[model samples]
Target: MIPIADKYSTFARFYDAMSGEYPVYHAGRNIGISLLRQRPGAQVLDVGCGTGLNFSLLQAQVTQGGTIVGIDRSPEMLVQARRRAERNGWTNIILIQADATALSPAEIGSRIAAEGGRARSDAVLATYALSLMADWETAWANMVSLATPEGSLCVVDMQKPVGLATVLTPLAKAACWLGGSDINAHPWTAVKRDCVDVKAASARGGHLQIRAGTRRAGT
Candidate 1:
């Protein structure tokens, strides 16, 4: 069996096409980014940023003056993300290839600064990404560490669908399995616990949970 990173590396070429962006996952992203509330000149971190799917929306908010730091573990995915940035004329993007779970906060902060971004971002977002990390809490802590003291943090991840969408449970499970994610991860619970003034939203019958909030002291 292919390792999870290898799976993503191999699938990078076809990820955007097969990732169900339009009819399904887009809603959570829209809400997550909105909750970030970043300013025009602020810097934002995109953890596990595959193919830069969130770039266009983030660029619109940050404008030409702001910077977007996109970090992913897969080189193949970063290639696609770089291509997307080039094709879209997005010069403010800095792409880093690193494993979020392994890298320390200081190391990543230095890397970001070396790549022309601020050491600490004004906002950080991980969408449909953390559930894949077995040590997702470590990733979440590192994410918060990379943010400014007063920065906003947002997590958008999957869960079992509720209400009418419960009928799609099998499909959801299959998708999560294929994607190497734990459908029961509930990664957003970290944000609720560690952050203040938390905001929450659910979409696609609770299959997607969106949580955003300001970083709390000592978090």
Candidate 2:
């Protein structure tokens, strides 16, 4: 079996098209970004930001005045992300290649500062990303370290459908399997556990879980 990183690297160019963005995953992303409520100049971090699928939506929220720092472990994925930014003439994007689970917050913070963004961002987002991590809780901790005390947080990921949608379980599992995600990860629970004023939404028959809220100060 192809390792997840290599699979992503090998298929980086085709990710956006084949990622089921429009048919299934896009709804979760839309709801997640909407819950951000970021200001025009907010500095936002996109963790495990594969191919920058969230860039366009995030840009619409932060605008030209804000900065977007996109971090992903796959250099190949980052290549596509860079291309997306360049194609859109978006100059405020900063891309970093680092393992979210293993990164040093202090070091990465300095890097973001060097790029003219704040050491701690105003908001952080991870969509269909954390579930792919083996130690997603660590990644979630890193995300918290990278955001301000009152920063907004959003996580969107997949699961087996429930209730009437249970019929789609096989399809959902297949999609998660193809993408190398842990269908049972349920990473968004971190938002509910560690955040405040939490808002929740689900799409694609609960196969997609969307959670967004503000990080509890000092948590």
Models 1 onward score TM values of: 0.98, 0.98
Flag clash pairs in model 1: none
Tens digits of per-residue lDDT for model 2, 85-181: 9999999999989898887889889888887888999999999999999999999998988889999999999999999999999999999999999
The 10-residue segment of model 2 with minimum total lDDT is 107-116
**What C-alpha lDDT, on a 0 to 100 scale, does residue 98 get in candidate 2?**
88
Off by over 4 Å in 1: none
Query: Which lDDT tens digits does candidate 1 get at residues 147-186?
Result: 8898999999999999899999999888899999999989
lDDT of 1 at 134: 98
